[model samples]
Target chain A: MKDIIIRGATIRRELFFFLLSFIIAFGMNLYAIITFKTLWAELLTQLPFLILVTLVIYLIILLARIVFLGINKLLRIKKNKSSV
Target chain B: MNSPYKSRRAFIKKTIIGSTVLMSYPWLEALANESAISMSAANKVRVGIIGTGSRGQGLLYNLLAIETSHNIEIAAICDNYEPNYQKAIELTHGKAKAFYDYRELLDIKDIDAIVIATPLHQHAHIAIDAMNADKQVFCEKSMARTLADTKRMANTHYETGKILQIGHQRLFDKKYLDAIDYVRSGKIGNVTQIRAYWHRNNDWRRPVPEGKPELERKINWRLYKEYSCGLMTELASHQIQVANWVKDAQAVSVIGVGGINYWKDGREVYDNVALIYSYADGTQFIYDSMTSNRFYGLEEQILGDKGTFELEQNKMYSENPPQPAGILQLVNNIEKNIFEKIPIGGATWIPETALEYKGEYITGDFDVNETGISLEVFVDSVRRGKPTPGLFEQGYHASVWTLLGQQAMETQQKIYLPEELKI
Candidate 1:
């Protein structure tokens, strides 16, 4: 039950990151379209590009999360050693 | 997305697509064709500049900018004012023959066309004289100071059969053309009302040469009644022309009010004006101009049942904008979590304010130099030995209606366009 709960929390976190990445990517695409003064319908055709940008953002966010966790773990270990 | 459609590639694709779309327009296509035509030295159109004032110098700059591209030459320049004549001569690099009298400039047989940028009162006589001299004429807007003079200018054009193109540069503006096309396509439905205004905060005065107060009236001709109709002819004429173009009809009647409310600088013309022009189809064009507030600098808001076009900003807002479709809609649904449903039962609720729809641009490129393009088109017409169709009529109607609006203000009554003024 503990393992299941952990897995569920991990999935929710990943979903949140992905959603954030998608929003940023979509906003960037919309900005580009409006700036170019082209038809807004072109956003539909730019789906593949939008997805690529979203995935890149998601990867970056995941990498950042890993680095942050490593730093937090190191600090916690240093505290444990000092306490000992 | 990874291999071929990266950001750089996307930019390139958009640029290509945008240019292709622009090229499909008739004016751009014509401009391309015009640029392709090369002329020999002997075939160049020899042109003259009349009234080398501020406006004349502006036209001269545009003319010189396109001299090589359009196969045109500034053969001569004429200005009675000593300072303007000297400045014009300097601008031409002393290549153009300088003349004190415009009649001497007109006498030159080599000059094929002349651009008249004189004061409002001088437009009709100079343009009429240029036409009689067998020279193609390009005169500035507010064709003349009075309705009779405006009619006379049009009559002279009809009588001479010479190419006469007025300086209504918006007729050649790409953004305006595209917006008009959209309006005609019924994208905005029928334009029922147009609210246009030009507001500025300045004295509208030109500095006299130190200790030369006598030159004040001559230098600042726009502020005097004899020389100009002030804000109406100088500023409102341009917006009125746009309103007329959007409606495709001239103002049938106008009622106006004006006063020299703010400046109190002893200028004969009004410093502020507000007018309502009624079109034949009952379309109302409300126009106002002032020199006291600079907030809403200038705009012609063409409103219709379906949408509104803020022309100066080159933006269009729709009453009923389309919902996001395909990928956008999918993303929006996922973000909003489509599975969630909220119950709503309330008293009557309605939006009682303007919709916050961010409008879209009317055209891809908005950096068009309309004045330069207008001059280039005039040169092209001169080369072809024919006038641009509908240009003269547009200028004529705009000038006539604008003066009538001024008349309405002075008479304190609704003024109608006289039948004789209709060409």
Candidate 2:
């Protein structure tokens, strides 16, 4: 079994961390590949769609955050303008 | 031609029974009836309802459809909205007494139970007061808007010992519960993350007959932050609560932003939002909502190392490893056993059977919200004096909703939790 690693670097502080991460990452990747038949499986490694979605969603979510901030600022300015 | 037990019993019981038996041969078969199905315990409860808005009338329709003997009665109905109240009146078939104020209906002696479906701001105040009145209460979701109110609700319910069921109905859905089981059973192999979203178009409007902008906002409390926690509480509460259920832990931190964009109309809350809610175990829940796009709709996709399940209300699709992976197929070249049991007798000739692959299957139930499984459970808990899932403490979860939006609006920075916001 592969040990848990972050960015291909094995965890040194705790051996169990390596084991846990390896199992989880492997299993999730395997499941993701099997379900969606995604590109992650072509490289002999499994991928997790859950993680993919999570990452993608969060990325869009950040964009949404910026968009909201812009709108909030605009509204504040518009309110001040009308009052003046 | 019928036997004496059937023929003589009918004669002895009643001459009308005899007429029925004689008529059952052909023409009068329609007169026969089946016995009602019932699930009753010793203790029974009669219920009253306050605030017959859209949510309340939904509860009313579900209550009327129950043919079981869980000893529940829609003894009273109350609503400030006249049309909604009228609809509830028709739905209950005038079986319950109608009222405008909840206290007046609570005064009725026979109404031993109350279900509050009022706006978010009034949940704690009404529910606590009802509990103090010694009535079992089933309050709708997002119990209150403030931490202090949530604490008071938790206190009152704990003290009164009244059967209180908060209306986070997803807790009662079969798909959600099974999804929890699938993840917890390690089928997904330590589910590290989840994504939940709901998308809609058309600025949440239901024609105001004659009202000021303030009145319209008051009527449609969901569009305003003063009465609602916006989409986080109104819509995302159901999904966010499930994140805890599936991940088996409370969210540790949350960071997000929102703004009113589409159909501004001077609403206080935002039209779109995206949040990354972190859990104590380092897993994260990504939740979002948008008003400009209804194409994506609602979905909750959970991924684990072992498997993945994508859910849309009653429809659920789960993906496990394929059968071919476990099979040798036409060519007997492959033999990979994920979990192979040792031969019992240690004899090859004795024939150890190869692991059978049943393949994968999808499971789904149609018309989930229409099925009323959650409402029936609420009523059963009330009547049997039993506890239900998602108690008033779950309302404290709404505190996170308030905390998330308010902090984001005020600080203009991502929000982090100093304490575990759990009841």
Candidate 3:
């Protein structure tokens, strides 16, 4: 087996993808919180709660990435088998 | 060993003080473990109710009936109308907080779910808002006033991935389930047609107070086009839902004829309607509703080549006559004098009597009410964080076709449901 390493360009592309994902996840949750009229003065004062929300969203995005990559690999294998 | 009820009660008491206290109560812990009672006080699903009219109140009663079994509490109730709001509050024993506006009720954080029993037009807005609030929704049937609103509600359900249960109680009805099974199992032999009708003689109106003539339309919303589609949404929706369920498909097209033949006193909606919806498989559902006559009140007949079943009557009639019972056979033989030596028994000696076919009972004693069972299912789904499958689509199809039928009636032409609206 050959040693594998990710290139700088590949790492940059991955970072861009993660940044976009984070924006989408956080924006959606924030929009939901505002829509439900849950952004009270008391709740807004709590920094830990906001941080926890952000962390949960990050975890969700990470899980989604794993699931999507797994599905992509499965699809590629299926395509190869069909070609064979 | 203590009874399940006793154990559950004791567990509730111990868990209420604290989990530490519950751990110390070894008997309660053992009872809870033995009974598999996993729910604690925090796990109880809090429900907010919108619209406390007759239908909404009935649903509240059903919810209350199943509260103990399902671990649900009516946290809040909302109705703009003062009388209804007060009545609903009283019904809840003043346990639930009452709100004049639904939005105020929706603002509460502890409410895990919302039951929307508002008029037809308000369903989409409230349901979409509830889902946006990250609350599971159980909206009453005739999902929305327009095809566009119906589509939006359905799409929102998909986008949110929250449990959206529409108020189609027939879906949870054991009798209807058994009937569907019988129809699908070839007992009815390919249901070719369904005839459904709801008839009443009285004016479909709630009496308004003498001082408040301006509130006439508001009080009797069913008679107005702005708030409701009259009998189509109020009555025919139930039968149409059953038809769609039995066929296992929605109508492709519809044609209808309706008019204000009776009760035309400032009413916007037609008093009589006759519509036919054609399914993809060529099965037709013939529907009619009238306020002029109350005779033959309401029923749905599922007709096939071999047999026909009247769902409301709970009776099944077969095309081929059934064999007579042993006593009846003996009686027939005695009447015909077949056992005795027949003096001049001819080939066509004259039929003794015309064969009569009285149908047999198909439904048994169902102790559980349909609405109660449906509420139980809805609460269970909300608690489990998953909707009862296929319920949303059933409601959507029924509502779409109902509106399509209304459109056909209004346009005076055949109406085909647009492809986009099919889902």
| Model number with the top TM-score | 1
Error of 1 at A61 (Å): 18
lDDT of 3 by residue, B1-423 (tens): 333334334434333234443333232233234333346797798999999999999999888866766677999999988888999999999999899988888899889999999878899999999999889999998788888999999999999988787888766444565566678677878799999999999997798889999888778888889988898988888898999888877888899999898786989998999999999999999999999999899999999998888888777888786754332343355457856665675675666773477887765743336666566556666766866556678888888888888999999999997989966
Model 2 residue B414 lDDT score: 66
Model 1's number of clashes is 0
Better of 2 and 3 by TM-score: 3
Q: What is candidate 2's lDDT per residue for B1-423, written digit by digit as tens? A: 232223222222232233432223221121122122243544445778898888887777666655233446787888877887788788878878998887888788767788888888888888888888878887887767765676778778778888666777665444564555556556667677799899998788666767454558658888777788777677887777777667655676777877777877877877888888887778878888988899999988786666566655433333454534211121123123434566677665855673343423223432245225545555555654645444444445645554564465556676665454445
Alpha-carbon deviation at B272 in model 2, angstroms:
0.8
The numbered model that scores best in DockQ is 1
Which lDDT tens digits does candidate 1 get at residues B258-281? 999889988999999999999899
Candidate 1 off by > 4 Å: A1-84, B1-38, B324-351
Q: Each predicted complex: what DockQ? A: 0.06, 0.01, 0.00
DockQ of 2: 0.01
How much DockQ does model 1 earn?
0.06
Ranking of models by TM-score:
1, 3, 2
lDDT of each: 0.84, 0.63, 0.78
Give the range of the ten consecutive residues with the poorest summed lDDT in model 3 chain B. B22-31
Error of 1 at A41 (Å): 13
